[model samples]
Target: MLDAGLLVPTAATGLYQRSGDFEDAVRAVEAWAGSLRLDAYPRRSLPPILPRADFLQTDYLRSFPDLAGIVSVFTGGDAEHRALLEDLDAGGNGSTVLEPAETVLSSAVCHSVYPTLDPAIPDEGLRLEASGFAFRHEPSLDPVRMQSFRMLEHVCVGTPAQAEAHRDVWLPRMAEGLGSLGLDVRIEAANDPFFGRVGRMLAANQQQASLKHELVVDIHDEKPTAIGSTNYHEDHFSVLFDLTTPDGNLAHSGCAAFGLERIALALLSRHGLEPGHWPTEVRRELG
Candidate 1:
């Protein structure tokens, strides 16, 4: 991509500035996905960072601390600033002078949405769709394993059956959607990269129960990339956020999330770098 002027690299390993063509491709993918559901789900816009308190409530720190990106800033006074500069000049790390901010970089696009949901959901449930930037601390040379990237998610909150149904419905739909773009796609059970030994157990249980499914496509010769996923969080967010269904039972939540950059990369990988030369049907679908 860098050779083709689609992605511009920086000093950071997993961070890069995308070219206009790259951005356009991402937008087209998002637009195509949005068109699949039309206006049935209300759209939401969210910031890249969320409150630390709310983040903590999600138990992400315990589950995926290695992938969490915390926002840090210099909150020091003038004297401290001078010392910090002097220290940096003396070959000290500037991060020493920074403190954790009130907010943390959001790891998932839907984390902020849960806090804003009504305490009691209606019988029909609540559905929302959002596209925003998400961050993860993992730094890698693989373009698909981006440290920061755009994510498009459709979130549902309601009873367990509704949540499961939401995930079930989107799993194949997303697979077919990506397949329509002329990429080989498949749906398979998957697990989150949980942390530690306990997390291993949790991951195993999660996979065993088929709680998460990914739409994967081959972007690299070595391994396939998960361009999208459907996860059914059974009463997880609802318990933390104090959400309940109309019958007073803890609500369940699920989300269908797509990595816009990954999809764009997949398109470039499969259809060549030139968008104009892509298949006519794919071009029309993107439009």
Candidate 2:
């Protein structure tokens, strides 16, 4: 059960250690991130959670209200809560409803990716690894829904066609990679976290347009939880943040995300954590 907190407390000594499924996921994602950043990767984070002005430009906050709720805590609040809320409230005087958000933290970390873009990466293609802690506010204490969580994403920004192609290239590789570990994986059209009213249209168009795909696992009672996702934001972030291609055309972006906790939970729930008894093949891959 969710014991009323942000990040779930674990009895395991080294949470980052590859001692269990959750830990293994964390470790692997860290490895991937480290390797990617080493090759001159360019990335950025929202100075504050995110300004209401910026989100409005991209319609990102309106689309993903849950994440926005987490961003709102930054606008104003008590010191302790402010520690987590990151000053991203967009609700001050405009349509920014993110002020004093429901939760003092982000419900998920991946949303932070669209908020910033580093223009230095040559536009032939840009590869990036973004990882961070995210919070979601709700009654989801299941080993699956810890209020605060971690996420790792690999992003590629270029042209619309290239963005889709990038997703295509990684989708199968990821499926096979997870499958090697005995995960039952499937791809499907996924929905964005669009807030209310007008934002729904943007989300619907994005979905109908098949701009995103999620790699899900059957974690919660046979209903696959989205562990990995690929999104093609054709000029959404570029136009919003003014990201451009080497050729000076508006760049299109696609991202692949791995929900650290959810993936870890899936690993633990399906396979035992003990390195000795665990499948030798998968264990070797982790090492």
| Candidate 2 C-alpha lDDT tens digits along 1-287 | 12222234566322222234345556674564334332467544322244445445655455665544433433535663554444345333332323554333444344455555575447467777767766554434355655555777777877777788878877776776667766798888977767778778877898899888888889744867887877877777777677777777888888877777676667655775443466777666655
What lDDT tens digits, residue by residue, belong to model 1 across residues 1-287?
Answer: 98988999999999999999999899999888777673487988789999999999999999999999887889999988998999999999778788989999999989889998878899999899988999999999988989999899989999999898888888888988889999898888999999999999999999999999999887854478899999999989999999899898999999999899999999999999998899999998888
Q: How many residue pairs clash (N, CA or C atoms closer than 3 angstroms) in each of the candidate models, in the order given?
A: 0, 7
Worst-scoring 10-residue span by lDDT in model 1: 32-41
TM-score of each: 0.96, 0.71
Can you give the lDDT of residue 177 in candidate 2?
68
All models: lDDT? Answer: 0.90, 0.62
Model 2 lDDT on a 0 to 1 scale: 0.62
